[model samples]
Target chain A: MRQPIAQGRTQKLDSKRHASAQEILDAAATAFSERGYAATSIDDVADVLGCTKGRIYHYFRTKGDLFIGIHLQALEWALEAVGPTAERADLGPEEKLREMVHRHAMHLMNRASYMGPAQYQIEMNLASEGRNKDEQMARILKMRRQFEAYYATVVEEGIAAGAFRGTDANILVKAVLGTINWMHVWFRPGGPQDSTVERERTAAELAEFAVRGVVA
Target chain B: MRQPIAQGRTQKLDSKRHASAQEILDAAATAFSERGYAATSIDDVADVLGCTKGRIYHYFRTKGDLFIGIHLQALEWALEAVGPTAERADLGPEEKLREMVHRHAMHLMNRASYMGPAQYQIEMNLASEGRNKDEQMARILKMRRQFEAYYATVVEEGIAAGAFRGTDANILVKAVLGTINWMHVWFRPGGPQDSTVERERTAAELAEFAVRGVVA
Candidate 1:
């Protein structure tokens, strides 16, 4: 934010601070994605931005704050990507679910650096302590549940529409989302032939395959 | 070990040394899975085993060494579970893949503590350094490739038999394995309802779903 910005700050100053916070988050996400949460530090995040740790501390009070910010933003990006498709009234249930999975797969890959840290950090540290982190983690967890809800809603619609297999909806949703969540394991950003067409094809094909799994 | 005793003594204490190493790995794995590699320490692993640090260092030289040991053991267990089905001559390509996936999923959940750390550590630090680590890393990499090759062979056969969707085998294999690999992300072992019946059902259902995606 230049979050938690104090009360006397002007609107224009707040915007500049917000941009700085965004910049720090971007750098922190990369560091966390590469080294993971336990290994990454505020200094490393600062180094990623070619700035001193003070610049990071100017917006983030601690490493956990940066992580919380990254997790929040990652979920927000994911919700933005798949939310509209999940709610589209014109599409049938199967079509809607397929599009949601497709957008999610694409989002996971396209913004992988952003999502990578969130995936690694959130899973292991649900019980992490500290007052600010507790609140932030709760918000992050709620947002994550909302993201899962989007998928759950579409999967339920498909089942009720008689297009999806009559299996446990929780299991079905997790299995479908697994195809999207496991991308960071094998994704390498600096391939010699990392073409957009290849990436898009892979995402689309994966979406199709995932949907076919639950199709009755 | 013929085995090397924990503290670098290369002795003929085969069975006991092996047993102790196994126990240490079991304990270390639980710690690593729960806390992640960077957050976990040798002390934490020792605490899990209810032993002192000396006991841990006696079998393995360092935490990295312990991680390497657990990873090798996990892959060994995985290969044991699925390797036979993948090579069985009586089964068709689709049945073979289904069985392999089933066994792998079951193994992952059954030996979750063993496999969870492997999933997290191997994916992040493929390029981790050290002489012992470098050599061990290569063997681990080779075993992983062998695991993938099992799926690749069955998938190619499925495609040739007109039993599987004729998509790229690499992407297909990764997607299918993703269903198995994502278990560590969501699996919670201490639930009151964590019965064998439920675990078997999940593994079976997930295998069915995964294989369905590839079925033509």
Candidate 2:
């Protein structure tokens, strides 16, 4: 006799599958960071997650899809981190920029598992063998431009108010954002300067240095 | 029967082989740039050079060797660019640091084919399945430290002389160098801002921005 499947049970199983997919993404990021995106295999990511290759393929059709997924997650978190500051009405342009940078730095250092490899998306784009390379890269680049526009908005406002030195807003954004982005390359968790206090100090230092570069 | 090889002819052949090897390295860098290091193959490099794979193998036993070779070339160029400025006793620390950053930015933008992949050495190390990972990475890191020391020495002297604001010389060095190191990602030779005059202006802008951040 066949038993009817319960709708409630199916929904529970769906949630569980979502959780497993998240785990796969996390494992993939770690493997990509350790083994380089090209060198890392689906089997390796499965091994890290203690799952089968079929399970990974269930969610991601290819390794490039998984890499892009991780990047999207990181970009979402980054935008989320700074979105509130960008929207705050009470803060001046400099304060908004300062808080935005501080939040982004903290988000990068804290969630570096995804953020580290996310910064390497350009490299991933170069190596992607996916059928959808152009479409995927265009989407990612669009998100990146939007992310950059946040800072550009602040810098333009700062210049208008005579708060920051007049410079090419585009170049200035790259210079400061480059400093923050480089954090993933040098700052390591559990390394010599990896304590909570040290991480906070570093975030502060980076924010101060970056903000000072543009202050009038 | 084959005639005995002439001594002068043998030497001339040796030099030609050396020149061919240099061409392979250049071609490899371009391939690595277009296709990330892991995705790039010796066959692709040989294709770019219109030569056979055996020719590349004659100079580089493995892709990792060729990758490291590009890195060494770029590092040598970078050190060469900054070394003269570092040694000029006539210039003050501020002037030396300014000139050093300017030259390095120019080198990065001009020789992006090599410098672009050189900065991606960290990614290469992750992807490298070569047996020489330890030795190659150690050599590269040693050279990187030496390259960084040029900027560090100038920053230290600037701080000591009260010419620049005091900050952690190491962290400050990373911040500014990160800005310059990031040029390869955004600057393109044939892009709208790729004119020689624009390249020079961008270099000056970056150097000015970096040095201004430290001025007391």
Candidate 3:
């Protein structure tokens, strides 16, 4: 009976620690999005969580570790949002494209915490690091290629199915992704329109343009 | 006779200073492009120039000032290449578009030193800084908007003359600019094929795609 109680306590403690780490990640994402990666510090993240830097250090070994972790989490969120939609075998090419576009735009506008930082890191930080920065960057680039490859597959399949024209799949994918990603540079949170509505409209327009551009 | 000698001496001095400043800016652009705005330092720029940090400080008041100067010079190079093409009223929309596309691609592929770093600063580092960063960003944004407006006018004229379709000029401009700007992210120097052939092919393909997309 005593052994069972000790095991239960340990499991509970482990779950609590996991939850704390997630909480810290959430706080870090918000801070990074608002303040940027360079301007933000571990202490700022801790302060936002009403915790101490020690707690962050307990979960993340270093500031770079925390940043890389945040980058990975954000990439995961983006992949989860669009990956499954693009991979659905039952949907026709056009339908799949529309759904993917909708989900991607919505994710960028609504989940700015994740997508915003991902964009910042990719567009800004990746090229700025030195030789010592290769390991972290290599991991990030691998994940990025995976993400881009998923889109490229969808584009190629669409063209093969006669849904899209015979333009270069690589270039078409880059164009589409560029339009989608560039939104982060210009998107404002609370301007004149509802964020969701604006994103939906923009996504629909871009999807229509891309589909028409590639259609037979 | 004294006045003539004094003028000659001043001209020689000015020419030497101009050459030195140009060399420093070139080195600074490479360092900032490779290491990024925040990660790069005056010492690094000086080392690249085979000089000391004091020499860089003599030319640039601060790192920020140097970055801003490099940014402006890069914009000037791009404008010099593409601006004149956009201003020609005699050419048809398709022809004009073709010229713009060709020149823009050539500029990017050849002048990667200036254009690459300029792109990095505009897309990433501008947002990474604080409120003080806004002035520089605003200048960049303004120039970008002007460039877009130039394309929009061409698009509108093309549509009016029955050479193009009446798509949303704003969206079309964004698509074109986005595609062009994204080249820096993936383009490499002497990686695979001849740069000129690759750029020409890309420009032709993109122009064909854009024309088809916008035609009624």
| Residue B9 lDDT in candidate 1 | 27
Off by over 4 Å in 1: A1-13, A126-132, B1-13, B123-132
For all candidates, state DockQ relative to the true structure: 0.57, 0.47, 0.34
Candidate 1 per-residue C-alpha lDDT over A3-43 given as tens digits, one digit per residue, 9 for 90 to 100? 55321223456577778877887888888788777766677
Clashes of 3: 1
- Residue B73 in candidate 2 has what lDDT? 80
Clashing pairs in 3: A165-A214
Q: Write one digit per residue (lDDT tens) for candidate 2, span B1-216.
A: 322121122244566666776788899988887777878778999999998898777666666778777887888889999988988889997788889989999998889899877885465354447554677667778989998888888899999999978867788888888888877777766787587888788888788778877777
Q: Compute the lDDT of residue B193 as modeled in candidate 2.
A: 57
Best by DockQ: 1
Candidate 3 CAPRI classification by DockQ: acceptable
What tens digits encode model 3's per-residue C-alpha lDDT throughout A1-216?
A: 112111121245567776777788789888877766766778899999998998788776666666666777777778888899877899887778767766777777777776776764554555553456577677777878888887888888888988887868877777667666766655656757666666687677666655655666
Location of the lowest summed lDDT over 10 successive residues in candidate 3 chain A: A1-10
- Model 3, B1-216: lDDT tens per residue? 112111122245566766787788899888776666666778888899898987777766667667776777777677777789899988989788767866776777776667777764455455654567566667767876666667787778888888876756666666666667766666666777756777778766666555555656
| Model 1, span B57-158: residue lDDT tens | 877777777887888889889999999999999999988998999999989988999898887566454444346467677788898999889999999999
Calculate the i-RMS of every candidate, to one decimal place.
1.6, 2.0, 3.1
Q: Comparing 1 and 3 by DockQ, which wins? A: 1
Instruction: Provide the DockQ value for model 1.
Output: 0.57
- Pick the TM-score winner: 1
Off by over 4 Å in 3: A1-19, A44-52, A120-139, B1-13, B120-141, B158-167
Question: What local lDDT score does residue A184 receive in model 1, on the 0 to 100 scale?
Answer: 82
